[model samples]
Target: MTWTSYGATCSAPSAGYSASTFASAVQLLAAAQCFSEESLPDSSDQNFAAYDFIIVGAGASGCVLANRLSEIEHWNVLLIEAGGDPPVESSIPGYHFSLHNSDFNWRYKTVNDGRTNQGNQDGCIYWPRGKMVGGSTNINAMMYVQGNSEDYQRWFDAGNTEWTVEDVRRCFRKSENYQDQLLDQDPDIRNHYGHDGPLVINTFNSTERVRGNKLISAYDEIGIKKVKDINVANAFGAAIMTVTASNGERNSMSKAYLVPIKDRKNFSIMKNALVTKVLINDLNQAYGVLVEQNGVTVTIHANIEVILSAGALNTPQILMLSGIGPKEHLESKGIQTIVDLPMVGQNLIDHLLFPITVFSDELTENSEADDEFDNLKYFHNRSGPLAQNVVLDTFAFYATNEDAKYPEFEAYVLRKRKNSSGLKKEFVTLFRFTDHVADSIVELNQNHTLHLFLLSLLHPLSSGTITLSSNNPKDPPLINANYFADDNDLELMVSGIQKLLELLDTEYFKSIGGFLGRTRTPNCDELELGSREYWKCQCLDIVSTVFHPVKTCKMGQLESDSVVSSRLKVHGVENLRVVDGSVMPNHISGNTMAPCVMVAERAAELIKEDYNLY
Candidate 1:
């Protein structure tokens, strides 16, 4: 019986549950096969009772690290993820949008600062982190971007020898697979990229090429020539984007690394086993993690070490809970302070993106997926528009701010709205005036609106911090994303919108005849271009985050000011290492996924090299 029937069976007559509910009574049975958690090694599997190394939070870092460290075939490695398992649909590329706002996402919201001059009074924005086994890697927009050279070199300049630009390039090379579409355009790009790597990075294959051309033209107008590949080093203008997909499907770390080595006798996974705290003994070294499963608290000791890959949000929380944060803060919360590291939860950074929406009366997303004939094709051939991501398309990189010489904002053009393809026939005829379909305007075609993602990169300048709300490990870490605290972040986004407006005035855009000014939107009318304050307010109202949170637990020699050291060991603490985004000393100017994977690789090497595990 299933959980539905079990729930019904447990209800009393007064509660309205009847005898008819007996059909699906699995919940009443209390069987171990309940689908709450992903399948892992059975508790009764005494053969896998303990491991030499146990990593927590099977995200981008944990999954990659687990697969790599467990490859030794002799040493046992157990990876634990608390988000449980994903529904079957989540594993498929077609159901990507459906997974959002559902169980698969972390669904974290912002702290809601009242400083915003406009918009909702709640002052919070919905921030979703991947809660499933693969973490955010499973749920991100799939943009594959390596950080800028200056970003990495800044780390070395700040005393992180392990994070020199060359070292980072080597790490990216180990896990990167350059796209054919990008390299094919320019053969000189062949040696520029590293193809034979673990991570599958390829360009999104689509039915139409309008978005790509638009991005290319936008960059040309801005005087930034498109580069062969951003990951190849120099990144300046909008070019075709490469995604982390394998054959038009998402290549999550679980699939790329973990599952392939699942059957390795020494490797084990404990899904739904929430590790509450890191157990440190008198030596102040991490001995093991304390986990709670099925109302039972079980302590699993790792003789060698414990790596915390819980990500930026939870990693710092875990450290503080394990008595490894600032002394005063921990003591006030009634938890014994193991190490006084003030910066454990400070210096949190994220990319805030403002959606610049414009109406297109000529073209809309080609959603042939809605047709009955297309349904047959998808069910049988697995081809056509359904196989492609509607949100995937061309991207533009350029400077939107006066002070910024490099690209400060990015635009991702889409022919189809995310998950909105099959719902309406409006997308196709929406842009009726554009070049591609203008000749067929008598057919009542509508153009598509541009979803301009004004991403904050290059120099965010402003930073935030993460702190523990309580000593309880169960409470979520308090996240205060001080977004838009920097003046440049606001100025740059306004410049980006103005740039888009400039694109509108071009003959090409004028020919289409659908201008953002005629839309009669409230905010657009209120926006005054001459004043910085007005533009800044507009930026705050329109801008949102790109879900790239990093540097919560920075690494540095200053133990009091840093969360972890260059070795990723928690400053002032022994045998405890942070192998996730938390170890970054500062924010990178790109998506954190690829960088996190690189960090995991470097972390594994650091652990192995330091411990001499090999």
Candidate 2:
């Protein structure tokens, strides 16, 4: 059928029905049927059965552990998740933002410190974590960035001997199955990645290539040279990112690792299961978990170990609820302390993002018709704007000092079309910007297209903490982001903003008539708009997270400072381990998804060796 005829058919009324309508309607019906048939098995019937290994939180790490540990045919493994299956929108890359504030998201909000983030809604920042099987991978902008080698070097130097740069790289390679077309053209990139793994990694099929390339050129002119592959170059430049997707669909850890072995006799997956506490014995050994599922609470035992892959935030909460946290803090909440590990949730670190937006009159906005056609195009062959991440597939990483081994700043570019429909929703609902700030952005978009440069302080000296709001597991953990707690962090962010402002002077930007757009904030009205002081003011008022929280349950050589050891074993507690981003000693220089996978791969090997499974 012709494309024009299909479009006409989609708009036809009931009385004007034609053969084209039947054809188009049947395609959608068939697609829905296929989606319904693809479902994960709910093994809740076997909830009472004991397991050799019980992994809490079916996130990036937990899913990997479930797949790897269950490989041994004799061992029984249980994977429990707090949320149900991912929705159809999760599979579409461009719909990544649509998952926010939905059932799939944990929808966490940082406690309003009444100091920073004052320009956000309710004077608090929104932190969205994925509650489903793949965890944040289901909601994240699927960037596959294995942080700089020096990041792991610091881990090794800080008494985490098992995490040497070489070992870290090897684990990343083990979990990656790089499928980008560049592999056939570049030997260095080809040799740098694993080719036989289950997780597919490829560049997004971006439809905004012309504008994206122009932005890359602008970045190069500003000293962030365009590299063919940022991964091979150690994240020293700007480039199109590789993503965890295959054939226009998100390849979450659940899709890559769990779906293939859903029917394994030894593997059991329990969905909508909330693990309230780790069941520790009188001797401080975690034997199993107390799970609240289907409105019923049950104790599921584990013969070997109970691993906490419940992410940086939830893992520590679970530990504290089970009486394995700070002695005095547990007592304050009327829980007997089993282990006096004070660092259970002390060292929280996250990458804070500030917007440095620029407006251009030369760019054109996408129309409603264009969006509808793009949706139809995706249903046809999965090839359209809907098949890729929304203008988020490119990135620029740079260091303040030219000789620095790791990047101090990371920039993400997002384009907002002029007079576009979702601008208010994006600024208010997704970003939680205050009414004035959101209105300013929406108003500016009516006249000029916006190029928002979201600059993030990659490694902040300032760290926050996750503490118990109450003794109840159902209560959300109290998150004190404590951003800009260190003066040096704000200084670094201002420096990064100053450097990014140079992009307006680039040839591509100049040709497009680009000019710096100021968001109206009452706190910064007295200062000069483009001055360093004004940028610093904006940093304090407009800051939000990139949702990369780590190091809450830090790993180190001493129990005096850390909650877990080099082998991932919880200090002062036997048969309990933390395998998620919480074990990170420090924040990585880039995104956390890829590094989380690598951490899990290494942990899986460590578990196998300790148990003699191999």
Candidate 3:
């Protein structure tokens, strides 16, 4: 089938595509059944007996653990997930945003804090988590960014000695299987990236090349040199982003690690099974788990350990429900506390994004490149705009000021905001914004303006908590991110906005007719557009989450300040561990998925060593 936009239809394929190539693509598509609904293996094929390891969530970390642990023929691993297999839409890169609030998402929202979430309605921000087998990675914008080296160094300095930069890089390399196409361009076959592993990492198709070049040229003109490999230590600059996609399809954890081994005799996966609590005994030893599936309560014993991979939010909740949290709060909720771990749900850190948008007279939504034609092209050849994430093409890391020890700002280029009304919004009565400015933003957004820099604070001093709203496992927990509680975080964000303005003034940006000062930020029209004071006010008003929440069940040396130990074992408990984003001691300088995978990679080795599995 062919598609037309602007009254022009062409059967001619893209530059790299040809009629013979299309024939091969068609064969591959049919062979792989790429668009078919997911068919998860039936757990009944294997007996539901006691297991060597019972992983609580079939997410990024859990899937990795399942694959690695089950490699030993003697060990039996049971992976339980609260959601079913991923849908066809999950494989499409551009449908990342549309997956939110669907049945695939948990759709949890944080409690209203008068301090930050000022722009959100009722002070609450929509926090969407993937409810499917792969967890958040299934719904996330498939960006594959290994965090900066310094971020891992801080973990070592914080008493996590084994998590040094060199050590973690080994773990990253172990999990990565860099695509041959990507390495073909480099020619050196560098040791910096893993050449053989389960996960496939590569760059996007040629459709994004032009937009990436434009963004790189604009940044290069402003003295930010084009960095070919940002994966190296201390490296910075713009380049075509690396992603967790093999070819055009998203290579989620399920696709990369789990599905290939689903039929293994020693491994089993349970879907739509909600684990209520980790069953602990009199000695505070976790021996099993109590789960609710199909409205029936079932208990499964674990012969070895119960690893909680329920993510940053749900992991702590599961622990607290099992009576392993702060003593005072547990008693208040009428639950007896087994351990007085006050730090069970503290130290929550997230990356906050502040958008600076501008109008582009050169571009419009109805331009020759439209969504329908792109979709048609993707269906036919799997090489088009739909194959890449539309949110942004390029990313740059920068230090907010001279005092900073690490880069604090990560500015992303988001060019499309049409159909962006689905984003969170606040009632004007609650947030105090003028109607004219809000209307202006709405009007410009409809006219196909460019969403310039979404300035994200890589490190924020503010922290929040996750508490049980009620003693019910089915009810959502109360979450307060407490964004901008620290003055330094706000200052850093304001600095990032100023840096973006500096980029807009560059010759390359001006040549593209980019002018940011023309449109004033919503509710801040009383002040000058380019002044520092006005930007600071706008920063406060527009601050929102980048959806990178972590550090709630942080890893540390002391029991007083942390829930899990450096080895990922929960303090004061036996055979219980948190193996997901919740165990991060601090927020990493990049996306959390890669780090989550690394944690499981290391955790598996530790478990193997402790049990002498080898």
Best by lDDT: 2
- Candidate 3 clash total? 0
What is the lDDT for 244 in model 1?
81
User: CA lDDT of 307 in candidate 2?
Assistant: 95
lDDT of 3 by residue, 1-614 (tens): 33343454322111121123433443334224444223558583455668989998888899899999999999989999998877656776765665675777788887876655455555566678889888888888777778888788989999997687887888899999888475446644366788788998887664757766777777777655677755653436666677888667788898778977878888989888899999999988999999888897888999999999999889998999999999899898887899899998889888877767675655544543354455557766777766877656677776646555567777777665453442223213222334543455556656545565677888899999988987899999888888788887777677677766676677666766766733344456688876777777776655666788899899999999999988899999999988998888988887778888988998888889789864
Q: Report the candidate with higher TM-score, 1 versus 3.
A: 3
| Model 2 spans > 4 angstroms off | 1-37
For candidate 2, what's the RMSD? Answer: 5.3
Off by more than 4 A, model 3: 1-38, 44-47, 180-184, 187-189, 233-235, 364-369, 402-405, 417-438, 446-448, 517-525
Residue 502, model 2: Cα distance from true site in angstroms: 0.7
What overall lDDT, based on C-alpha atoms, would model 2 receive against the true structure?
A: 0.85
Write down the TM-score of every candidate.
0.83, 0.94, 0.89
Report the lDDT of model 2 for residue 204.
Answer: 79
Model 3, position 188, has a per-residue lDDT of: 47
Q: Global lDDT for candidate 1?
A: 0.65
Q: Give the least accurate 10-residue stretch of model 1, judged by summed lDDT.
A: 10-19
User: With candidate 3 superimposed using the best TM-score fit, by how many Å does residue 129's alpha carbon deviate from the native?
Assistant: 0.9
RMSD per model, one decimal: 8.5, 5.3, 6.7
